[model samples]
Structure formats: structure tokens, C-alpha cells
Target chain A: MQAFDHHTPQTLPEALALLAQHDGTARVIAGGTDLMLYMKSGKAEPETIVNIKKLQPLQGISATNAGDLRLGALVTLRELTRSPLVLESYPSVAHAAGFMASEQIRSFATVGGNLCNASPSADLAPPLIARSASAHIVSADGEREIPLEDFFRGPGESALHAGELLQAINIPPPKGNAVYIKHAPRAFMDIAVVGVAARLELAAGRCRTASILLGAVAPTPLRARQAEAALAGQSLTDDIIANAARIASEECAPIDDIRGSAWYRRRMVGVLTRRALTALSNAQPLHAR
Target chain B: MAKILVSLSVNGDPHELYLDTRRTLLDVLRDELGLLGTHRGCDAGDCGACTVHVDGLPMTSCLLLAADYHGAQITTVEGVLDDGKPNSLQQALVEKGGIQCGFCTPGFVMNGLALLSEKPRPTEAETRAWLSGNLCRCTGYVKIVDAVMTAARQSP
Candidate 1:
């Protein structure tokens, strides 16, 4: 890896101040899984690294007063996977966390790092976007909340400013069942070729509301708004689900990469979208399961 | 660049050292402490060759900064064996044909050990998922899975 100075900050304010002082020359290191790889590959050559691992306040899983799930920026994927609240209330998010890298990588890869890294193929994005999650960003000025949907700008990019630090992700309790599914060449540690996250609020055997997010098939994790519109106020029948999946597949603009071809990814999007809907159809309350 | 003081416990032994701020846990283990069992293959996090147990959970040591891990406990492949004797997983791997070229064996062993720590008797699917990150280009993973299963059965 390239040589760089490292600073371990004990507080978020301290970390943000360091970032501000360094004028974005410093990269905040949480898990360092993605950042370290970038540094090693010469993709990132920051002058300094501000380590936020020592900040205890930015850790844990909790429910806020607004009934939203609050996840600290430094909360590792392993912790998220093991959190009963996440598994029970937001199985899609938990499942997405579980499917990330592996048990070992999950132990250190933080959700904040995953989001800030802003890789189009990031496993956490689709799930969070489907759940209508929001990001809590802290900078030298103060904190601001941004919906996860508005967070990503493009590949390897995010809405975070130069000195802003992503504090936590707030996931509003889903109104209905949610499921995250991905089609990777292999089950573990591989990036998704096409990943889908579906949230459906069903009432009296009819879909009252829905949100479908697609990943690895676009510049960023994108909400399949057209497909979501097709599912609203309709029963998830074979034709309806198939049509919705088709719309989702059509909405995505995937690019060919080493992980998969664009054609393969588009095909998998349809397959995964259908599967996610099917899974959501049969899904029971997490506690009962 | 000034070296930072890092105090950490490795395999039950506490040690203090001064290291460059950019040094990774993998570097500290192999270069500073001379614990070369933590093989450094694919310095990137893609490969689990440099996996080690940090605070009882398996993590990619290459992704961790040594200075930031002050007071953290790390267990490497060398720590998995008992007094130079191969652990049950290691023995099972030998018996089950899990070892071929042996470059990836240590990582597999460490990952297997970490898995059993979490799930004492993991199902076949669970075992496969746990060892998925540790790549074994030589054995094709058939024997590695068998070895973990056999080891679990042999334990207790």
C-alpha cells in the first residue's frame, strides 16, 4: 500500500475537524476494506487517513423515537447481520449485510464505508434504498439528514461534500414485507451481477405500496420507479410481477465489467426481481419466522 | 514520517511496537512480530489469505491499520495450532485431502477455526458459506468442505 499519515480520532467532531483542516486531503478510514484496496491499487492517494474506528459514539444499533432504525456509521456489517432488530424488522437489510463479502470481511466492513465508497455494486445500497433509509451526515458545520435515494450521484461518487462525514443510516420501519436478492457468479465474496431489493406493503391480498431498487445494473443503486408504480394498488399475480420485473429490467443501464456482461446482468435483473417479489409474497413476519 | 506506538495482544501475548502509521496489521504481524503464518496474498481485501481473528471475530488483517488496533487481540494461523500440533481442522484437512499446494491452507485453517468458534456444529451450507472467502485454487473446495465437516464431527 502507498505510504500515508494516519490519525485516529476519538470523536466525530474531531474527525470532521481533521477533515476540514486537511481540506479533503484526508480520507476517513472506518473499516478500511475499500479505502485500503484503493490505496493499494493507486486509485486513492490521500495525504492523510483519519481513522474513525476509535470513535465509540458512532457505533451500535438502536431504534429511534420516530420508529426509524438508527445504525451508527461505524457499525460493522457483522453487527448489523447479528442484530435481531435488523433481522426482525428489516430482514432485507440484514440479508444484504449477510451476503456482503464474507463472514471475515463483514466483521470489519462498515455500512458507512460501503455507502461512502459508493460502488455501483455495493450490496447495502439497494436494500437501504428499498427500505427508504436516510443518511445522517456530519460535517464541521453540523449534521444533516439526506434520504438514501438522493445520496448517490454516480459510480464511485456520493453527495457527501469534501469535509462531510457520514454519521449513520436511518431506516424507517418498512410499511410491509421487504426482501433483498442478488445474482452473483458465486455465493460468497463476489460482487452482484444484478441485485434487487423489494419492499411491499400488502393489504387484503393487494399491494398497497411498493419500492424496488436495482443495483450493479446502473451508475448507482436506482429505484425502479416505473416497476414500483406498476405494483402499487395491484395484486402480485404472475402477469403483474412479470410486467413489473420487465419494467425494472428495462429501466437499468448496465455496463460490461469483469464481473459480468451487460446482457447477463439485464437477464439476471429480471430473474432476481421476480425472485424478490416471489420471496416477498411468501414472506412472513420476521418474528414469526 | 514519525512512527506511532501500538500496543496489541497477539495469540495471548502482549507486545508493544513502534510502526509507520500506514502499516497494516498484516505487516505488523509478519514484519514487526515475525508471525509469518499470516500469509500476505492479494494485499487487497479480495483474498482472505491474510485473515486473522480480531477480538474473537475473523477479519482481513490487510484491511486493518496496525496503529488503530491498539489493545486489540489478534489470533493468526500460527495461533490456531495447539503447541505445534495441528488443530482438529488441520488434521481433518490432512485426512480429507484439503491440502494441495498449501499456500492457502493456513488461511483456510484460520477461517475454519473462526467459523467453528461462531457455530460449533455448522451445517454443510453454513460451512461452505463460511469458507467461501478463503480461496483454494488447487483443491477445488471439495476436500476443504469435507475437512471442516469432519473436524466438527470429531470435536466434542
Candidate 2:
């Protein structure tokens, strides 16, 4: 790895000031899982690295009085999965957290780093978007909140400005049960070929609202508006699910990569979408493997 | 880049060393501290051969900067011994024919101890999921699974 100056800040203000001074030439590290890889591979060469692990504000997972779940930026994936509040209240979040990486990686991979990495196949974004999670970002100037949906600008790009620190992600309690499924050759440690998350609000045995998102099938994790629209105000029967899944598969634009072919991904998106809906209707936790 | 002063405890021993900012915990351990039990295989995080415990949490030492973990407690494979002897997990692997290329043994033993410490008797599914990252190219992982299962049964 190329050499760089490293600083550990014990407060958010100190971190912000250091980042501001270095500006575009510095990188802030929460968990070094991904950043270390980039550095070792010579893909990233920031003159300075500000380690925020010492900052107290960025190291917790809690629930607010308003029934919102707050996950600090430094909360590792293992912490998320092991939290009783998350496991009981947000099964989708727990499943996605556990599904994305191996136990070792989870111990070191942070939620904020995962979001800030901005991979198209991000396991948390679709579920967080489905749950209406928002990111809390802080800079020397002040703090702001951006809906998780708008947080991503493109692959490896985020809306965060220079010197901005991601404090925590706040999630409104979900309306109903949820499911997140990833299609991959291995159950763990592999990137998603087609990741799908479904959050449904049901009343009177009919769908009141549905949020469907597809990952790794587009440049950005996207909401399948056509499929969401199809499932709205309709009973999820076999016919309805098939139509919705078909629309979802058709909606995404996938690429041909070593992981899979575009045609296979497109087809699997439909299959996984249909399966997710089927599981939701059956009230079963979905697992592809 | 200039050298940075880093302090960390390894195997109940504390040491402060001045190392280049680029020196990873793995390199610092093997070269600076001379704890050679932690293998350096696949410097990338792909292989868990360099697995070590940072505050009781297993991490790929090669991926971690020693400076980032200043004042932290780290336990490499060598530190996992009990009373200067291999622990129950290591004993099981030996009795169950789990060793072939011995190169990955340190990592496997470290990861096994980690899993058993968290859950004395992890279900087969749980064991498989937790240990999936530490790949052993030889043995096809059958004897490893058996060894870990045996250790779980023998553990208190």
C-alpha cells in the first residue's frame, strides 16, 4: 500500500476540521474493510486518512422515542444483525445485514461505509429505501438529512460533500413485514446477481402499498415503479404476481458481466421478484438457497 | 511516509512500536513483532489466513493498519493457546484428521475458537455460515466441520 498520513479524531468537530483542511485529498475511514482494499489495490490514494473510529457519536445502534431506529455510522454489520431491536422490529434489515457478507467481514464492515461505498449491488440500500431510511450527514457548516433513495449519485459516488461525515441512518418503523432476497451462486460472500426487497402494507386482504426495488440490475439501486404500481390496490394472486414480476424484470437494465449474463439476470429478476411476492403473501421468510 | 508510533497489546503482552504508516497489522506482527503464527496469504481480504482478534473481534489483520488500532488488544493465532498448549478446537482437528496442508491451520483454529466462544454448540448451519470465510482448499472441509462439531460437543 502507498504510504499516507493517518490521524485519529476523538470528536466529530475535530474530524470535520481535519477533513476540511485536507478537503478533496483526504479520506475518512469508518471501517477499513473496503477502503483498505482500495488502498492496497492502488485504486485510492488520498494524501491523508482521517480515522473516525474514536468519535463517540459515530459508534452505536439505538431506537428513538419516536419509534425510529437509529444506527450510528460506525455500527458494524454484525452489530446490526445481533441487535434485538433490529432482529425483532426489522427482520429485513437483519436479513440483509447478515446476507451481504461473511461473519468475519461483518465484524469489520460498517453500515455507513456500506452505504457510502455506493455499490450498485448494495444489500442495504433497497431494504433501507423500502423502509424509508434517511442518512444524517454532518459537515463543519451543519448537519442535514437525505433520504436513502437520493443518497446515491452513481456507482462509488454519494451526495456527501467535502468534509461531510455520515453520522447515522434513521429508519422509520416499517408499516408491515418485509423480505430481502439476493440471488447469488454462494449464499454468503458473493455479490448479488439480482437482489430484490419487498415491503408491503396489507389491509382487508388487499395490497394497500408496495415498495419493490431491484439491485445489481441497474446502474443505481432502483424502485420498480411499474411493478409497484401493478401491485398497488390489488390482491396478490398468482396472476397478479406473475404480471408484476414480469414488469419488474422488464423494467431493469442489466449488464453482461463475469458474474452472470444480462439475459440470465433479467430472467432471474423476474423469478426472484415473483418468489418474494409469493413469500410475502405466504407470510414466510424468504431464502433463495 | 514518515513512521507513526503505534501501541497495541498482543497475547497479553503490550508493545509500542514505531512503524511506517503503510505497515498493516499483519506485516507489523510478522516482521516487527515477530509473531509468525499468523500466516500472510492473499493480502487481499479474500483469504482469512491472517485472521486475528482485535478486542476479541476477528479481523483480517492484513487489511487493518496497526495505527488504526493503537491501544487495542490483538490476539493472533499464537495467542490462542491455553496454558502453552493447543486448545480443545486444535486437539479436535488433530484427532479428527482435519489437517493436511497445515498452512491454513492457524486461521482455521482461530476462527473455530471464535465461533465456539460465541456459541458453545453452534448448529451445523450456524457453524458453516460463521466459518465460510476461512476457506481450506484441501480436506474439502468435511473433517473441519467434524472437528469443529467435536470441539463444540466437548466445550463447556
DockQ, all models: 0.70, 0.76
lDDT of 2: 0.88
TM-score, cand. 2 vs. native: 0.98
- Residue-level error in angstroms, candidate 1, position A44: 0.6
lDDT of 1 by residue, A53-125 (tens): 8887689999999999999999999998899999888877888888889888899899999999899988999
The clash count for each model shown is 0, 0
True lDDT of residue B44, candidate 1: 78
> Per-residue lDDT tens digits of candidate 1, residues B1-156?
747899999999999998888789999999989998898888877778888999988888988889879889999887877779988999999999999988888888888998887898999999998887888789989999999999999889
- The pairs that clash in candidate 1 are none
Per-residue lDDT of model 2, residues A1-289, tens digit only: 7779999988889999998898878898877888999998889987888989999998888989998999999999999888988888788888898976677788889999999999999999898899989999999889999899999888899998888989999999878778898889998888999999988888888889998988999888889999999999999899999999999999999999989999999999999999998898777767422
Docking quality level of the chain pair in candidate 1: medium
Give stretches of model 1 more than 4 Å off: A282-289
Model 1 lDDT, residue A177, Cα: 84
